[model samples]
Target chain A: MAFPPEHEIHRRRFGRNIGVAVTLALFIVLVFALTVVKVTRGDPMQAFDHSVRPELAAEEAE
Target chain B: MSDIRAYEQPGEAGFGDYVQLLKPRVMSLVVFTALVGLLVAPVSVHPVIAFASILFIALGAGASGALNMWWDADIDAVMRRTKSRPVPAGKVAAGEALAVGLALSGIAVVMLGLAANWLAAGLLAFTIFFYAVVYSMWLKRSTPQNIVIGGAAGAFPPMIGWACATGGISVESLLMFALIFMWTPPHFWALALFMKDDYSNAGVPMLTVTHGRKATRTHILVYTILLVPVAVGAAFTSIGGPIYLAASIALNGWFLIGAWRIWRRDEAMAEADGYATEKSVFRFSLSYLFLHFGAFLAEAALRPYGMGGW
Candidate 1:
C-alpha cells in the first residue's frame, strides 16, 4: 500500500518502533566494540585478574 | 485486509512516555556522578569502555527508576508532584514499566560486566536492588527515616563508576558516595518542607509527615552539618586538591547557612513568606552538588600539569 497509516496512533507507533530499532542497533555496536577492546587489550584489565596495577593500589593507599 | 492492531490499550503511550518512565532527571545525576567517579580515578580507562560502562550504568539507574515508578504508581497518582508521571497519568501501563525495568536491569548489569568488570557489575546490581526493593518498596512508605537510608541507592553510581575504572572501591569513591548520601536527606527534607501538602495527602511517611515540620528542619540542619565534613574531606584524597578544597569550603559554608535559616523558621513564618528560604535552599542544593562534582572534575583535569591533586 502507498498510503500512510490512517491514524495518529499508528504514526506514533511507527516512531516508537524506529526508536527501539535505533536503540537496538546502538546496543549491538556497543557490544561489538566492547568485545574488540577486551580482546585487543594487552594487559589484564579487571581487578579480579590478580595483576597489580598502580591505579588499583591508589584505592587502598589514597 | 490490513487487520493488524494499531495499539494495545485505551490510552496510548508515546516513546517519550517510556523514556519518562525511566525518570530521566534522576538518570542525569547518575550519569554525571558516575562520569566524575570514572574520570577522577587515578587509573585510566579506554574511551570506548568508559563510554559503554557509563551508558550501562545510566541504564541500570534508569531501570531502577522505572521499577520505582511502577511500584509507586499509586502514591505517584496521589502526589501532585508525580501525578503526571507516565504510569500514574495512564500514558504507560504498570506492567510495561515492570517489564522494561526488569529487562533493562538484566541487560545493564550483564553489559557492564562485559564492558568493565564483574565487581562493577555486582555493584550495579546491588544498587538496583537497593533502590527498587529496599528503598522504593520497603523504606519509602514505612519509615520517617526513609530518605536517610534510601539515599544510598542514589549515592552508589560514583562508587560504581570508580569500580569500573579501578576495579574496586576506594576512600575517594566512598567519599563521593557519602557526599551524595549525606546531601540527600537535607535536600529532600527541604523539598518536603516546602511541598508540605504532597506527601501527607499521599500517605507517604515523609519526615514532614511522620515527624513534625520543626523536627524535619532540625534534621535538615543536622545532616547539612554532617555533610560538610564529607564534602570537604574529599579534598585530601588523590582525586582532590586545592580547587576541590576551596569549592567544598564555600559550598558547605553556604549550604550550612541555608540549613541554619531553614531550621530557625517556624511554619507560620514559612507560610507567610511562601517558604522562600526552604525553596531557595532547595534550588541551591542542586547547584551545591553540581559544583562539588565540577570541582572534582577540574582537579582531575588539571592534574597532568602539576597543579591539581594533593
Candidate 2:
C-alpha cells in the first residue's frame, strides 16, 4: 500500500497548502464574527444594568 | 561521541508540532462555548479580565489535548485519523507532552483563579482531570459508552466560563452544559460510523465497534431526537431569545432530517455509496453544535431590545 513517490510528494504539498489556507481563513472568519458580535451586541454593562455591589447589597438587605 | 546527540539534534521542535500537540481544532470549540458562557452570564467582568479568562480556559483545553495525545500515543499510532499527531509521529516526545500539559494546566488554572474566581479555577482543574484521567485512561478503552460519559469533559468549559463571570453556577450554565453533553454522542457516533475500522483496528470500544452499525445509527437518531427538545428548551431560558428560538428550530429540523436519513441507511447501501451518508452526517454534526451555540450569541445580542427571552 505504498504510495508512489511523486504522488506522495503531491499529496504532501496539497496538505500543506490546504492547512495554511484553512488556518488563515479561520482566523479571518473569527475576527469577522467577533467584530460583528461586538458591534451588534453593544456593551455588556448596558445590557445587565446591575453591578456587583448593587446585587450584593440587595442580597444582604434581603 | 554517541552520547553527544545534542550536537546532531541541534534544532528545537518546530512551532507546528507544538500546535498539533494542543489539538487546536478541539480547542476552537472550547473557546467558542466558553465565550458564550462568559457573555451570557448575569455578572459583568472587566474586558481585560474576560479576555484573560478565556485565554486561560483555551490554554487549559489545549493542555488536556496534549495530555490525551501523550497518553494515547500507542493507540493513536494504529488509527489513521490520529496517526499523524505530534507524539505519534515522534515529532514530540511523550515526556515533553506530559511536561507541557502539566505546566499549562497549572498556569491556566492559577491565572484563571486570579483573573476570575476560585470556582472557575476548580472547574478547570476538574475538567483537566476528567479528560486526562477519567476519559482517556479509564473509559476510552474499557467501555462502549465511552464518548457518552467522556463527553462531560468537553462539556465543562462553558460552565467554567459562566462561573468565572458570575462567581457561581446557575441553571443557565447547566443548560449550556446539557446542550453540549446531549450533542456529543450523536456527533461522535457519526464519526464512528465512518471510521469504524479505525476503532476496530485500534481495539477501542467505540459504539460502532461494540454495537453494530445499525444500533449505532439508531442511537444517533435517538440522540438527535432528544437533542432537539433540549436545544429548543434552552431557547426559553433566561439567556435565550427570539433569534435563538428561530435558529434552534431551523437547525434542529435540518439535523433531525439528517439523522433520520442516516437511520434509514442500510449497511450495503452505505458501503455501495462509499458511506456518503455517514460522512455528510458527521460534517453536519460539527456545524450543528457550532450553529446552535452561535445562535445563543445572537440571542444575547438581541437581549438589550427586549427581543430575547420571555
Per-model chain B TM-scores are 0.97, 0.96
For model 2, the DockQ equals: 0.04
For candidate 2, the per-residue lDDT at A3 reads 48
All models, DockQ values? 0.45, 0.04
User: Model 2, which residues run further than 4 Å from truth?
Assistant: A1-62, B1-4, B7-12
Question: What is the C-alpha lDDT profile of model 2 across A1-62, one tens digit per residue?
Answer: 98434533344446667776886696466456545545665633233346556655665678
Provide the lDDT at B204 for model 2: 96
Q: How much is B246 displaced in model 1, in angstroms?
A: 0.7
Compared with the true structure, what per-residue lDDT tens digits does model 2 show for residues B151-269?
A: 99999999998999999998889989998999999999989888859999999998888879999999999999998888999888888877788988998999999999999998998
Candidate 1 C-alpha error for residue B17, in Å: 1.0
> i-RMS, every candidate?
2.1, 8.3
The CAPRI-style docking tier of model 1 reads acceptable
Output the lDDT of residue B136, model 2: 96
User: What is candidate 1's DockQ?
Assistant: 0.45
lDDT, model 2, position A4: 34
Candidate 2 chain A TM-score vs. reference chain A: 0.52
